[model samples]
Target: MQILIVGGGTGGTILGNSLARRLANEIRAGKVRITLLSASDKHMYQPGLLYVAFGQMTPDQLYRDEASLLESSIDFHVDPVTEFHLDRNEVKTGSGKTYAYDLLVIATGARIVPQEVPGMAEGSENFYTEEGALRLHKRLMEFRGGTVAMVVSLPHKCPVAPIEAMFLLHDFFKARNIRDKVKLQYNYPVNHVHATANVARWAKPEFDKAGIEYETLFNVREVDPVKKIVYSEEGTECKYDLLIAIPPHRGMEMVETNNLGLGGWIPTDRFKLTMNDHDNVYVIGDATNIPVSKTGSAAHFEAEVASDNIVSVIKTGVPVREYDGRVYCFIEAGFDRATHNAFDYINLPELKPPTKSVHWFKVAYNQMYWSTVRGLL
Candidate 1:
């Protein structure tokens, strides 16, 4: 059997590692082969980008060699996928390499599209990329005091990231003793501040205490770089000296080019995590159009379910496991405090107040994530 996993991000890496370990005996006997495809050699710890923007972490700290994280039994291919031929069960890469597989997992993840919003590329400082985070770090360091608007362009990966960035900025300004001079505001397109109503309710008090003004139902329609103003289609306007914007996110070009996505996201069976039109093809992580948090924890949970089901289908010709839509996130509330939220499709997330220990746990998790990839945690 030949197994091919695309995109060496968190979902792909975890699933590859899990399957490699589970099928070790078959791999050793040369009865099964596993291959992973990645666009780059470096695997980024994406959640740490917020810390990078806050100057709490460097880029090097969040990156590891993609090939090093996988088991020896799994083959790693460092190349960008140009086309996905689902009809033929073949993948073509930029280097003109073609791969055929019995089972395919699409974990290509989300792509940030700053160009979708007018003047966003020219005016706003994005924290979603490494260069953007480092640029924001420098800009934040030089900022004396002014209005800082944190705008969300569209539904994005890591739904809590904008909230976390806003909270951390408050702490950053407060530490510099410029909190009074700097005004913090958040604008989101959603009806509520967060995906979960209860989580949003729980976060309100924290924002209130920190003096962070939040506006829901404010979708950014355009940004004027020269005027330093953001306009919402709802006729709302905000002026800012510094704009930290979360741009629109969509599925990868490979999926889009292949017409595998519905509205730029791969349409999948929400519980089974399998592609809607193809039974042998699975979708996980940020690529899927499932109603989940789109966080690393969600991907990790999805990987677990996908890996188990793949193994079962290979052995018995049937997938016996199903994904639960589980999602976990640590809301960084600044001031060395954080809150943990966990929930699934059927369960509402319980609200836990921020704590100093939970913040430490988040820090520790960043380090432990690599171990988890190695199947050590």
Candidate 2:
């Protein structure tokens, strides 16, 4: 059996490593093979981008060689898949090589499209990518003291990231002794500050106490870079000296080109983690249209479930276990205080008060993520 895992993001890396160890004997005995195809030779620690925006972490610390994180038995390639022949259980890569597999895992992640929003690409700042993080950091440093407005859109990766950014903005100004000079403005598309009820409940009062102004149900319509104003779909507007946006996201273009899913998000079984009509094919992470946050923790949990089922099917001809929409996220509430949330499909996350210990744990996890991708954590 040939197992082809596409996109070397968090989910693909973990699944490939897990399968390599579990099927080590099968691979050596010429019964099974595992291969991973990625767009680049590097693996990025995405969560570290948040810290980069705050100057707490450097861009160099966020990357590792993709080959260095994988097991020796797994075949890895830097050739990105340009076409998916799902019906034939095959994929064509940039190098014009066709890989046929008995089973396929698509963990191709999502991308931010600030260009989708009118004037957003030119007017707003973001930290979703390395370049964006560096640019936002530079903009933040050059900022003297004025209104820094945060605008958010839906279906983006890391649901709690905007809240964390807001907290960081508040603390950033405070650290510079210009908290009173800078007016931090926050806008959300939903009725609450956050889509998660518990998170909204926890952060609303915190924003109030910190003097950060907020406007709910304010979907971004467009921005006027010349006038320095952002208009919302609700007919509301906010003027700012600087704007930070959590832009909208969509699954990879290759997924859309293949007509596998709408908006590039493949139709996937929430429990089985399989494509809607393709049992031998699995989709996880930002590629699946599952009702879960597109965070690394969700990807990690789904990869484990999917890899376990793959191993079971190969060993005993029956699959075991199911994904429960589990996700865990750490929120940086201040420079030295942080909190986290853990939840699954059946349960809602109950947030705790922020503490310095949690902050340190988050910092430590930044390094441990390397071990995580290797399926060692």
Candidate 3:
């Protein structure tokens, strides 16, 4: 059996490594093959980009050679697929090479499109990319005092990032002894400060205590760079010294070009993690249009479930278990304190108060992420 996993990000890497380990004997006996294809040779720990923006981490620390994190038994390629021939169980790559698979996994992930919003790309700074994070860090260093506003668009990855950015900004200014001089503003599109109800309940009080001013129901309409003002669809506007935006996101262009799903998000079975109407094709991470937070933790959980089911099906002629929409995310309250939320489809997440110990754990996890991609965690 040939298993092809596309996109070497969190989901594909974990699933590939897990399958390589579990199917070692089968592979050695020439019964199973696992191949992973990715666009880049470097695998980034994406959550660390926030730290980069804060100057807590450098861009070099956020990356690892993609091959170094994978199992030796797994075949890894840096060629990105340009065309998906799902009907023939084949994919054509950028190098004009075609590969066929018995079982396919698509984890192509999402891309941030600040261009979708008018004037946003020109006016706001974002930390979603390495260059953007470095630029934001430089801007933060040059900032003396003024209002630092955070603007968010819907359906972005890591829903808690903007909230975390606000807390970090508060702490950052406080550390610089300019807390009184710098004003922090958080603007969200939704009516609540956070899309998640429990999270909003917990973070709202913290924001109030930290003196972080926020305005909800403020969907970004356009950014006036010359006037340094951001206009919302609701007719409200905010003038700022520095604008940080969590821009809109969409799944990969390849997914859209292939007509796999609307907006490049694959129609996936919420529990089984399979592409809708296609049992042999699985979708994970941001590629799936599942009602879950698009975070690495969600991808990790889904990969585990998918790999387990794949291994079970190959060995026992039947699949075992289902993804329960489990997601475990650590919320960084500030530079030195953190909390976490763990929930599944049937359960609502109950967030604990932030603690320094959890913060330390999150810090340690940054380095331990290598082992995680290797399927050791």
Worst 10 residues of 2 by lDDT: 153-162
On a 0 to 100 scale, what is the lDDT of residue 55 in model 2?
Answer: 97
lDDT of 1 by residue, 226-281 (tens): 99999999999999999999999988877788888765699999999999989889
Model 3 CA deviation exceeding 4 Å by range: none
Better of 1 and 3 by TM-score: 3
Give the TM-score of each candidate: 0.98, 0.99, 0.99
Candidate 2 Cα deviation (angstroms), residue 26: 0.5
* Cα lDDT of model 2 by residue, 157-264, tens digit: 999999999999999889988888999999999999999999999999999999999999999999999999999999999999999999989999988888989989
The residue pairs found clashing in candidate 2 are none
lDDT at 293 for candidate 1? 78
Over 4 Å off, model 1:
none
Give all candidates' CA lDDT scores. 0.90, 0.95, 0.95
Q: What ranges in model 2 sit over 4 Å off? A: none
